[model samples]
Target: MAKVGGVVAAGFLGLSGLIWFVNLPYPMIRRPVAGIAPMLLLPSYLSMDRNYREAIAHVEQADQLVNQATSAADIGLGAEKVKLAQENLDQLPVWFLGYEPVRMCHFMGCSWNFTFDEFSRARAQVGRMNARIFQENNALTQLQTAETDLQKAKQAYQTATNVSQQQNAIADWQTALDQLTVLPRETLAGTTGATKYRNYERDFNRVVGSVAGSNQTQTMIAAAQQFAALATQNSQKSAYTVTEWQQIETLWSNAIDRLQKVDSTDPDYLAAQSYLADYTQKLGVVKTRLETEEKSTLAIAEAKRQTQELISSLPSKPNPDERNRLISRLQGIIDQLKQVQPNTTVYAEAQTLLKQAQSKLSQL
Candidate 1:
């Protein structure tokens, strides 16, 4: 009976040892075994300690890389380091072990305690790094897009043949510059964008000046000025005939039309606008003059016709009622003649007719 009990005990001890040996690599599985034979888990504890140390090292290196990063490539490398650190932290079996393996093996002169705090901190760092990477990458994309637009705008401006094309190119160039101005200054791409913006702004102004100095813009301005001068010279005359006033009105109108055609993109556009306003006012004046001349000429003719009709209709020696009617008609003709304004072609004729009507009224 004693010998059978000894054999069974030997078999049980051998099976337990085999289980401990096979489960040494897995902390969760070997944790219970450690309670029965703590000495058997020394190798597993040392391995866990190494992983923890490696994870901490990775975290430090990642932090350093990220802090010093100046470009997207540097940030990418930092991201890889962060990933490696996370992988190392994941391998650490902190769930089953309450203390670091280094702490468990205190005789090895290591005193670190295992806690999820460091793991959590690492994870937080990863989140921050990822956010930074996203920001930098997005800024890089913006920088690239802005640069491409700037190049295209330059090309367009250099090759443009017309004012419209040059204006469009300048507009595009301004849009590109606007894009660069909005980038975050902390990013590598943003810094580069800023440097480019200063140079591009100067170029943009130069291009605008070039477009303004183009032959088409200058020619248009000259033509507008010529028309304005002609209109000014012609409008200086007073008391113009209806036909003459109409021609003066046309001259002012032509000047205004030419000024209106000057493109806003031209540097001379503001001057053109000033000329346009002046010309438009002159046009209104000339048009008023033309209208007055036509009206005055018709009024004088009408007054003369009425005077002749009154003379013909007079009853040789008019009765008191007929004389009063004739006098009233003459007074009305005089009043109408008085309304013919100065500066009209009919003013002189209207004055002569007014005197005749007044004399006829007095005679009646």
Candidate 2:
């Protein structure tokens, strides 16, 4: 009887050791998956010691009100708070919140393939092209860098697909999980690579002629506007020095270019045309200013000559009314001259001439 009792105790100890071994690593592995677990699983674990330790903390503060409640009405109020928390939990989609752990693991592995495998090969390919930009921008090697980034973007798209798929698997674990995982991605679709990478690809395709022929005209117009801005800045022409005027022309040209790319009925094209008219009006103002400057210069010259001749023809005392009228006319000319921008050759020359006229007037 003593030996049998000893054997029974030994068997119990061995079983307990096995259970401990299995239970210890389970939580560690499950720790990562805890957030992804479904609402249905919450009730089952609520009775467990480990569950209370891991998750109850998020809702712990609400427990005091629940515990202190003395009536059904108070309990109902406490339950309402718990329901609100559950609703908040639902707001985080299963794809984003539940399956995120599995998705993260999958993405980390996929990222490594692009960085070491695909990117290195793409860089080698661009290296063979002998791209001029590589030399000019000292980024000859950077062509490979861009290709590497492009390849990585493609890989990220693939990883997004896998992450999405893993979320579906997690959802299949429970019906509620399925609803949480599936609904949000269906509503708002997005690809893997960063948004900036997508935009870069769009602008690059337009610039490099990868886009269809229909878009070519718009692309050319955009390029032309860029060139026009460069010309306006560096051109020796005085009227062109007005950067704002050049910008107006650039806007008009860009709008026309963009307009040509789309059907005339397209709203974007119509919007471009509207912007074109606005910039065109601005350019017209610049042209009008230029013309006004030209006319004002001639009027100033004529007024100076007439005043000098009149002064010479007069006796030592000029006619008081005529002298005053000439002075007033001279002052009007100066005011108009002041309105002209000094960047123009006509305005600069006129300013020098006006100073001389003022000196002569002072003598009178």
Candidate 3:
């Protein structure tokens, strides 16, 4: 009885040892299939044989990985590499998520050629490409530096709560990040630049947008009208210096440029168009007035020069009729100059000319 029991125990122990030995390489065998995963290249599946939640979840996971791959491709990882990686990752058994591996063991099955060794080689190929990006694109380093600058600016903005300081900090952050464009190549920078600019633009516009708000249309209209009013008033009075007139025109021009940028999608697009037309019309009137003022000034100058010549060539003996004509011409020039508003530079010239002409006439 003891000998039979000993033999049975030895058989049981040997079987257990054999089982452990067989399973020892299981972990190693499972790696490549799991590692390359949905990212590994596989034939397109007509149906993954998964329930709705599980299927959708797998797709979402694949999408995220593919998007990252696309970003990686921009830095020189070929698109095909990313596509193959995604294919490997998107399969079952390896990424079964829930269903039994045996159930999915159709077509190419899980453990056949899709083992850890192949996955490792594929992953290594991809990993090598990803690591190569930092080497090939020197701008990748510059991009990182710009990002650090943006972070610093953000910190400064946070520390300074004042609106002005915040605006400055935001502007600095944007400028620093914009420097990335010159450094980073388009392959990598295109997507990143767009994303970074979009984010910074949003932050930059926070104060601006809040201030503009729903009343953008109303505010634009009011500002335009006010600018028109000021310009028209100055032009009508002819009371502006050349420099002053130029400044007014510049202000109006800047306003128009801003109005043109009003988004077509804005609710007030039609209103903006109407206001733009009206402002343009007003600007035309102002331009016309400026031309008229300039022509009038030339006429006055001509009249003054002719009168001065006439006065200098006057007869020493009385030529009452000719003297009367010269005085009358000078008087006309003075009147023309005075007709412009008190603010007109021509008005001051007019006063001086009038005094001289009057004194001359009295002496004659």
Candidate 4:
């Protein structure tokens, strides 16, 4: 029983020693492992030192090839180097030493090629955007300038027309005055005769003599007629003479009222006021006509606003016709851009966009 007990005790001690040995922390030689499971393969790798040195040499050669390919400007030559280096990496043993740099070089070369192409595409897009903005800005400027010039020209044309009308009115007044002067005083005073008829004739002669040409001669003629009519009524010594006097006073009041609205500082305003005053004296009609003509006045204002809007919408830098043509071309380019496919190499789409933009600019 004692010998059996001794054998059992030794067996238990041997089992504990085997377990401790299997779980021991051991350092790896080439492919280092943190735990015991991989430590058993350490010796085999250490014994393959000759194969390991050859793998290191291949890795170093691949590194040199990657550097050469990166520096080369010739696309074909650089691509060839990258291919060669990749072939070397593929041929290397799975467990070769210094394997990571070889793998990294392969991926980096592929990635560098992709990034270069992408950058080129992005830069091309930026150029296209700049060009489009420039064309639109230039066109807008031209349209605005042209519109302003047109407005000034229209104003000048109207002013010239008004001046011509005033001259014509003055000529008509001179003709009226000549006819009145030849008429007998009794013929002008039909209903009643006045000794003051000669005084009205004298006043007309005085105004006609002071005239700086015949510009306001028509107005003076009308005023003379009103004065002569009043004299005829006064010959009867009737109250109707007061009414004729009031009518002549009202005509003068309307002329002065319109003249007061004119801004003397503005050249055009001065011309307009002068024209209004001349018409008032010649016709004595606007006081009754102005209220009825308000609608036409509003229409003119609306027309002016519409003209301004038309000019605003027109391109500024280019002529209107040219801008319309450019806009159509720009639309075509935008359609082309949409149809263009994203490229894997150079900026093919961006290049096409740039070409279209340049073509449109040439047309402009």
Candidate 5:
């Protein structure tokens, strides 16, 4: 009977120790057990290491999804992954083992070497992923709203019979475009919005320009004034590309056309005439700038072509005639570079080439 009681007591203690070992990674079990037998807390450290690695894997997966997400569905999936990662990280006892306890555990041949810093960094990565997902979802919503607004504006513009209605529709259209413009470009929705914006702007300009020969003189004058203002604003800016200058030129032309639509019998005919004169002058100026930009671009291209040819054909040992020919051609290239006007898109490039050409000319 004594031997049986001793065996039974030993069996109970063994089972209790096994239960305690299994649950030591958890705070509730580790708090009491660690106070009495801190050496046995190795299981808790091992569990923490495992959780940290799992959280890291989840974070990486979430990051990949968020970066490549093209739709709301993708963002939703990424959010789930990040949330799981956060939950896993939350299981770590960062406060409990952050100092002396972790250092002591390191001496016990336990391989759980994760630091508080590593844990914090992993949490921060998860946080950033969550933020990106939130931003992407918000961008998607904005895109949908912008698209709806665009459709409404188009419908209003197409059905309007009077100038006031058309003007209001135009305002709505601009607001829609503004929404698209402000979307975060790193997001999928923003990229889609950009493409839509380009198409919308082109179509809107074409539709606005199509209004002509209407008896609504006030409408014609108002449209003309708006185009004139846009043209002036664009024209006053420097460093416009050739294509940009051409668009500005088109604006001026559109303004002039609108003013010409005003009938002589209309009440606003005199005002339209005044606007026509001013717009025509601005159109002429825009045309001049366009011409300069084209000529300068052509000059730079021709200079580069000549320089390349000269480089390919130059003799290793040149006589006076060959040397003189090279110098003449280089001088011509320098002249071409000098023709590129300031405030043109290619002006900086041209200036850089000009210095090289001048230096080469002197060397020749």
Candidate 6:
């Protein structure tokens, strides 16, 4: 019975020692993907699932590539590799954060955490991430600059009052659109930025079309205004020859034609219509004045011609009757010229001729 009791005591002690050994806290060589149960069952800490270790190992490989890079051109390739490593780390499940004992914390202070080496390897990719961010920032800046230029062009186009100005601004807008590829990709900055630029492009084209219509109308209005000014100048003249009246007709007609060409949709179309009515009325006034002037001009020319012939035909003898007859004829010519009015352009010349004839009569 004593020997049997001794064997039983030894067996109990051995079982306790085995349990302690299996449950002992061990240091992590690599982070494991397996659950706590498997970590407890496996003899080696790294022997179960090792997906976390593989992901972290990718980060280390990327770091090696980054270290080999010497120039700015090589940095792009290195950043891509680093992004791959980041993708792997992102794929890791949340449960992969592991718990283990290290040399500093033997029994109670230990907790679930990333392995020190794995965390450092993942942290090493931060520089590469920063590089990619900087590249994106530069691209975004260029895009914004180009976008601002496009905005100015669009504004100029919308506000321009003439065809030439609108055309120049539209050309600038086209150039800006051509350079749209300089913008950073949506993957780099975001979809929002790219979407904003696209909206600008759509709005710009719409505004340009409106501007083209407006400018076309403005161009026609300008052309009409030039003709209208000339018509006004000619209409203000107190005297018009038959040829001058014909020229006035041409100017008024051309001005009306241009005004008629103004689009009905134009903002100034109603004003143009009103101008057409006003010009038509003025043209009638000018035509009436021209007819009166033409009749008066013909009468004045006949009287002057008859007076000059009589003055030339006067005898060398200073007979009172002959002199009186010549003076009466000269008075008739002056009376005809007085009807021409001082406001008339030919009236001044007529007055000079009247003064010369009166001097001849006074000498006789």
Identify the candidate with maximal TM-score: 1
Assess every candidate by TM-score. Answer: 0.48, 0.28, 0.33, 0.16, 0.48, 0.34
Give one clash count per candidate, in the order shown.
0, 2, 12, 12, 0, 0
RMSD of every candidate to native, in Å, equals 30.2, 28.3, 28.6, 38.7, 12.9, 36.6
Please, what is the whole-model Cα lDDT of each candidate in the order they appear? 0.75, 0.44, 0.56, 0.41, 0.79, 0.63
Q: For residues 264-331, write the lDDT of model 6, one tens digit per residue.
A: 88898998898889878877876776666676677668767887797688788858887788778777
Predicted model with the maximum lDDT: 5
For model 1, residues 1-364, the per-residue Cα lDDT tens digits are: 9999999999999978885675555656676766666556666666566777877787787777776777677878888888887787676666654634433456775423555786677678877877877787799899999999989988998999997997788777767776897798888788888998889867776667665345444555676678778877877767888888888787777667767766787777898898788878878888888888888888887777877887788788778898788778888789789878898878888888788777877766
Model 2 steric clash pairs: 134-139, 134-140
TM-score of candidate 5 to 2 decimals: 0.48
lDDT of 3 by residue, 152-247 (tens): 887887797798886677666655655654553334544566577667656645744643333445555666667666766666554666566676
**Poorly placed runs, candidate 1 (over 4 Å):** 1-28, 38-43, 97-103, 109-112, 210-364
Candidate 1: pairs in clash: none
* C-alpha RMSD between model 2 and the true structure: 28.3
Residue 33, candidate 2: C-alpha displacement in angstroms:
99
Model 4's alpha-carbon lDDT is 0.41
Question: Can you tell me which runs of candidate 2 are displaced by over 4 Å?
Answer: 1-215, 218-223, 234-261, 264-285, 288-295, 298-341
**Per-residue lDDT over 107-204 for candidate 4, one digit per residue giving the tens place of the 0 to 100 score:** 43321212334334433433443343343334334433433443443344335557566344334434433333323332212111133324533544
- Point out where model 5 deviates above 4 Å: 1-47, 96-112, 161-163, 208-364
After aligning candidate 4 to the native by TM-score, how far in Å is the CA of 297 from where it should be? 65
Question: Per-residue lDDT tens digits of candidate 5, residues 1-364?
Answer: 9999999999999977786774654566667765666656666666666776778788888988898986678788889989989988888877565332544555754433567777778888888887888889899999999999989998998999999998788778767766886798889898888898889867876776534223235555776788888887877777677899989988888788868856686667787888898888878877888888998899899989989999999899999999999898889888889999987888999999999888777787
Winner on TM-score between 5 and 6 is: 5
Candidate 4 has its poorest 10 consecutive residues by lDDT at 186-195
Output the TM-score of candidate 2: 0.28
